[model samples]
Target: MNRLRTILFATFFYILSVPIVMSVPVSALFGRRAVIRHAHVWARMHRLLYRYIMGVRVRVEGQVPAGTYFFAAKHQAMFETLELQLLLGDPAMVIKRELSRIPFWGWAAMRYGGIIADREASAGALRSMMRAAKALKAEGRSILIYPEGTRVAPGEQPPLQSGFAGLYRALALPVVPVALDTGLVWPKHGPKRPGVVTIRIGETIPPGLPREAIEARVHDAINVLDRERRDYRMVQAPPAA
Candidate 1:
């Protein structure tokens, strides 16, 4: 039954994605706002499919802050990647360079304000990412980045990529750590299960702290929902002073 639902969901999602993806170029004619409007529509449609067809629902704890913020989220599955765009009102997403090369989708991502970062930890790549992030910040757009750099199983909590710290320091924006249990339902490989994925927004950490301090805070905050962790439950800390 789950397999059937997955198949149906994927089929319809792909079918629905075509026209929207193609329309991105057309949206560009109307300017960036039109492109973002179309992107938001695309994200909302995916959410609807998740709720009605996949039987997956999202429960967000804590309000998403207003204005520009550095959103650092856990990467457990593909679910949050699209969901965050809608939830955060279309922030500039930090996506991999590979994703930015995918023909039309890549073109749309760039057009819609995605920051492309190479996975390799080279100085040049870091510089390039900072430049893009700064550009978006100047435009009054928030940024969403998966600090772990890749998805992991529900129980695993890997150290954040160096790029995360680099971008954090470069952007100097308050960081909102987002924790979730999406991997429990949306496995990296295989059909997704129907369940409520809880997204817990942690307190905003101020910018300009040392690399280690910021990284540690973000690591713990983003792992609050990891049941396999020592805490074994969600821990919502008070807002940072």
Candidate 2:
């Protein structure tokens, strides 16, 4: 039965996605904002499918900040990639260069303010990403990044990628750490289970802190929901002085 539901969900999800993906060029014709609006609609459609078809629901704790703040989030599944766009009001997303090369979808993503990072290029990638991110920031858009760089299994907290710190220091925007338990249901490869996924928004950490301090704070804050870790528990950072 669960398998059947998963199949139905995937089937309809991609079928419905065709038109939206195909419409990207038309949306681009209007303008960048129009493309972003189209992307938001796409994200919302996925949310609806998650709720009604997959029997999955989201429960967010704490306020989702408005305006041009930087967001660092836990990445345990592909779920948040789309969901955060809706929750953060279509913030410019930091995504892989590979994703940005996906033909039509890729072109639309760049037009919609995606900062594409070529991971293997190291220093050069960071330079390119910073340029794109700064441009988006100047446009009054918030930035959302999965600091761990890729999805990990539930309870596995990996050190954040160096790019995270570089972007934080350069962007100099307050960072909001978001933790979620989506992997429990939305495993990388399997039938998704029906459950309430909780997204915990941690206190905002001020910008301009040393690399070590900011990385440690974000690491702890984004792992607040990692119950499987023997030492796991929420460690809130003291209010920025």
Candidate 3:
């Protein structure tokens, strides 16, 4: 029964996604903002689908910070990726450069001002990312980066990618570490369980710290949502729309 629901929901999700994702390029004929509008609409539809089809709900505990800041979030599943869009309005997401090469979505993401990072440690790629991120900061936009670079299982503690500290130093903004256990309800690539995924935003860590200091603080902050922790309150997920 669960498998059947998962299959049905997954199919519905992608079917709806084709048009939503394509809207990016179609709207590109208008302007950058138009592309972003499509992106935002896509995010809202994704949340609605998750609620109605998978029985999963999302909510935040601490207040989402305001103004231009670097957001470091724990990556446990794909759910948090969409959840970030809802949490921060039209954020400049730091994603892999490879994703920036996808067909229509890639072209739109670039036009919409996503910061593309190269995981291969190429100096030129790093330089380009820093330049893009700085420009986004100047526009007073918040930046979201998955410090671990990829999704990990619920209980795992992996070191953040090498580029995180560099981006931190380059941006020189207060870092707001966000924690969430979305994987408990939404696995990497499987049927999602029915539950509320709570995202806890820790207090901001100001800039100017040494690399070691910043990484240590971020690592501890995001782990607050790791499976072993019992520090937060859970609420009933809201009903499907």
Cα-based lDDT for every prediction: 0.91, 0.89, 0.84
- By TM-score, is 2 or 3 better? 2
TM-score of each predicted structure versus truth:
0.94, 0.93, 0.91
- For residue 161, model 1's alpha carbon misses the true position, in angstroms, by 0.7
Model 3 error, position 159 (Å): 0.8
Task: Point to the candidate with the largest lDDT.
Answer: 1
Once fitted onto the true fold, the runs of candidate 2 whose alpha carbons sit more than 4 angstroms away are 228-241
Clash number for every model? 0, 0, 0
Tens-digit lDDT track of model 2 for 34-121: 9999998889889999899899999999998777899999999888989988887788999998898898888888899999876785
Q: What's the true lDDT of residue 55 in model 3?
A: 85
| Model 3: worst 10 consecutive residues (lDDT sum) | 227-236
Q: Please identify which of the two predictions, 1 or 2, would achieve the higher lDDT against the true structure.
A: 1
Q: Could you arrange the candidates by lDDT from highest to lowest?
A: 1, 2, 3
Quickly count the clashes in candidate 3.
0
lDDT of 2 at 195: 94
**Cα deviation in Å at residue 74, candidate 2?**
0.6
Better of 2 and 3 by lDDT: 2
